[model samples]
Target: MKIIWTFTLMMIPGVVSSMSVTGYSGGGVNITCEYDKKYKENTKYFCKGDWLSCIDRIRTDIKDKWFDDGRFSLYDDTRSAVFTVTIRNLTEEDSGTYHCGVDIPTGIDSSTEVKLKISTGQQTRTVRGYSGGNIIINYKYELIHTNHVIDVCKTSSDQCFTVINTNRSTEWKRDRRFSAHDDTSAGLLRLFIRDLNENDSGEYKIIVKVSEDYSFFSEFDLDIKTDDCCVKSISLSASAGGSVNINCKYPQSHSGDVKFVCWRSGADLCAKETPVNESRRWRDEGKIQLYDDREQQLLTGSISHVTEENSEYWCGVQTDQGHKIFITRVLVSVTDTVGPAAGWPVWMGITVACVTFIIIIIIIIVLYKIQKKRINCRSAIDEYENYPRTDPRTDPRTDPRTDPRTDPRTDPRTDPRTDPRTDPRTDPRTDPRTDPSEDTYTSLDLNTRSSDLYDTLTTVHPRPAVHQ
Candidate 1:
């Protein structure tokens, strides 16, 4: 059994300072040391060991020296009075005590000491998460105050672009990959890393800048996993003339596999395929970049100058035998660069649509109310038109006059005795001659006939005495 023990160098005296750096056996780091202004023009050298018999591996002269020895590079800045040394592709034998010293004319020269520890980290803690999932790493060390500074980095390398400082709000927020929360009460700092991929798997260091008095360091290892298929379908939206980068994941076992993208028609594959090496392949109009990362087993692609005319394409990989195996279908929607309302942005168009919908509903409601009001305003005369079966004769106002019985056009007068000539309604019982229906002609003729007959009868009675 092999046991590895690490010790902190804070126990050393003589203006004491120490920093512990942890890294993987195949990984690298950069060491930075600060000095007083008096050491500005002094020659800076990096050595491996205690002050006495330390091995002089590399040195720097006073005149802005830059030293490069393959895996190691050293730079001494005379103005800042600081020197930095970078080591790459390290191994277990490379781990040891290192010191940054300056050649001084006076007494014992000044130097800063640090310890480098290398391990495969098989004995340390680890975590696994999906490609698109998030991971929370907890550091339980107590903090001095809210002012405690913390930085999370992929490696111990100095000035690495992957270094994210928690003290600066914008630095962590700007990078979509990282976020942090400090729980002052529990003395716990939780780091949230998102949009993870296989490349994110590695050793990570946590640095705490407490004060000029001392500094603290902690390390964690991550082992990110993926689903069985590794890659899933992706849908992307962009504006006309914009660009989009598509990333797909594969297992490390599938290294050197041929990646492909082609147009698709329904369930059938289109004959035309895009060539990755060519600058323009997507419908002969898109500029594309294809990169295969053997270490991370990730294939990323970028399409530039995409318009709405660019459409459905399949992203896939070829097997060792060169058979195409599609993993995901890519749907790219390039929207109109200019919105419905001229010069308006996407949000403004959405707002206008909502407002338009509301206005339509209000207009419909107003029209319904207007129709109801017209129905309520109808007069009784108009309502009567609905009943066509009713008889006008049954109505007493057939003449539509107030008094039908004594109406001047119908009866002329109410009383006939007033003036017979003016009163067209004079009664027949009042004057016999005016009774045309019964005795108008017969009444005058009967009287004359009877008188004539009686005179004739008297004369005929005397002449007829003998016949009697």
Candidate 2:
């Protein structure tokens, strides 16, 4: 006995006039319908319905019947009018016969049938790209029944690209992974690993199948690192009247095989020395020079008679990979003095001698004035003793001879000369010998005691006295 089952389908108003099935349970199915047959002028079989109308009808009426528990659902490419049924979460219960049918308005209808048989094991496939624009495919593990094949489509620009797998041991095993054909490409095919692990870090092989019989392959390695280059430290030093030196060291990771070294001050790099090149006189305004050279060590050239102008001197080094720089400064000053040309001790002695000479001249002038006063007093006394007597008759001041009356009676004991007033043969007042007007004393002979004595002796003693 045979049992027959019939399922009724429903349609949405105004949008759909027909229904059909596009794909089935174990993956082999094809369905088509007449949405716009006028698009193909001679295709009279598909003349009446719009494309959206046909798709809407299939989605509404047949979608529930095709559900197969939770394994399948309806999909439509709205831009292309292609309706598809996708199977997922597959199970053995989903296997069945599918009927696709479309109802025409003039009492006519079209139908097609597809059979589905679900397999018990998993089937695997891979995608790859190749050189010369080809894709290579190798399928492992047999399916319970043959499944329909479709090209791996690039939704963008509708251009088909390829991928490749080169491991022969896993060529027939569906567990093998997929990879791009060439590691380096003119256009890169970026493979994004969601949660990358250590297993993701090695070389990857890519193969591309150009046609059913031809293929290409390449390999590439990926390396991962966690550390970066760093500057270790820098230092500077300067001495009086000398060039400053600056030292800079970078971490070993960054300094590994330095090719060349350079020095700079501020933004300008110092000129280098060569075998044929002569040294530039006073280069960089006499502020910089080449000092030393070697694999990793350097020194600055000697700077003579350094001055304030060199205060801003700097040093630097350049390596194969990077550059480092530093600066140092030096300061200088000189001594000075003030006062008299001679030292203070010599000036003090000269000032003292000048003061002593002036004091000696003042003492000599005081002694000379006292001696002159005594001489003047003695001369005045002598003039007083020689003054004539006051009586005019005997005063030499009147007759000028034997004038005892005119001469002063000087004390005999004091003067020791004979006093004119005490003469023996002369009268005090009237005697001729003593008279003030007589010439007796004036004419007296030195052999006679007096002129009167001579006259009397001659008269008394007679003429014989005169002859004797």
Candidate 3:
């Protein structure tokens, strides 16, 4: 089952190579190598500048001169720098040291050494079958080395090498219920058995010898089981409106001595024993009822018109040794029997309507308040339109006319002293200091005729009204 392998790589001026060696049972072995670069021109079976070309030349020379057997060969190509040497069809006698070397014209040379080993392969076999049938065996042989091969045979005529392992060992068994077959080409070992019995359970050994010093051995165990004396438990099935069957099976060996009893618990306990078919204990509030007592150990309980309230009942078995119970506490809800309440939907609808009505009322109140404020503002503006503003500067109460001298235009009749047209107010002579009122008229003085005319008018006064 285990293999050891070794790989190595080396590089020197103008040359690079890698090698791998594997060891297996039966002295089988393999050696492989790869070169670094392709060969160039000026290479007569060996290129001076190319590393792989030099390696190819060395590989060809070694195959032809050292190991020229049919199992050894060399592979090389111009497109790939890689050069490989293979040794196939390995055997115990083929294990030895292998070397690959390369030489360049520029005084550079590289070489690698590999040691090949071989071992006897381990022998193993596999057998498969049902517990109650005959056992079958298969054998196979595997070689550990590349150039090696293994062969297995049996010592007795009754049984031959039914199976072999990787070590090339022979597997043999003396059991009459089992048989084995071998395929040498495919390295497959097959086993066959008919009417397998329970007693055929044990380990079988395989022995193999390669030459005189090399040998391989292996062992395998077989087990068989019978299907008898099995115990089966009870299972119960029930539905909403239909009855159920509760069944239990006792061991066939104890069918006669075993007694069966049925019982129910929860709210009340009721038990019925076998043989007598009499109820030993009973409590009733319609709590627990024994529906059917067939065979005593198994019972079929019916809950007529099963309802949610009666779903918490328990059913089980009771015997002289002990008691077993099963409680059904799952509340069975029936969709047809229970539905939405009659007034629930109606009440919900009314509630939603009321909520909507309240919202509308609130909106109306808000809008009314807004409109009322607008009307009040309009009325205030209308009332303010009737009033007119008065200027304080032109009002009579604060007028300068209250002071007669301060008035720029005064009534001419009211101020006789200041009148310039009055003759009595003026002085005719050119006297500078005649009168204060006539001082302003001094410049308008007229001749004595003008003064005489004024005196005549004064003297010619009209007659007063006689009859008044």
Taken over the whole model, the C-alpha lDDT of each candidate is 0.60, 0.32, 0.39
lDDT tens digits, residue span 1-468, model 2: 112212212232222233322222223222332233322211112111333333222323332123222333443333343334434433466455443334445533443333444544322222222111111222222221122221221212322233232232221212123322222212222232211233333443322333221122233333322222212223333333434333322223333323122332322222221110122221222333332333343333433333343333323223221222221221222112322321223224357667667777777777766777777877788778876557767655676454554445433432324444454434455454445433543466667666577566445432221233
Lowest lDDT block of 10, candidate 3? 40-49
Off by over 4 Å in 3: 1-20, 25-30, 38-68, 103-106, 122-468
TM-score of each: 0.33, 0.21, 0.20
TM-score of 1: 0.33
Per-residue CA lDDT of model 3 for 29-83, tens digit only, reads 2233334353322122221123434323223433212333354544443344434
Question: How many clashing residue pairs, candidate 1?
Answer: 0
Candidate 1 lDDT tens digits, 1-468: 112222333333222455666545444566777778777877777788886667766776745666876777778877877787766666789889977777777766667776787655222245555565444566655433455676777754444235566673422232466766556666566666655688888877665555442344555577766667575568897667666678776665556666666665432343346544322223222355566665676667666556665656656555432334445567788877733343333345569999999999999999999998888777655878776564555665563564557675566464445657555565554443465423323344644666665465444432123343
Residue 259 accuracy (lDDT) in model 1: 62
> What lDDT is obtained when candidate 1 is compared to the true structure?
0.60
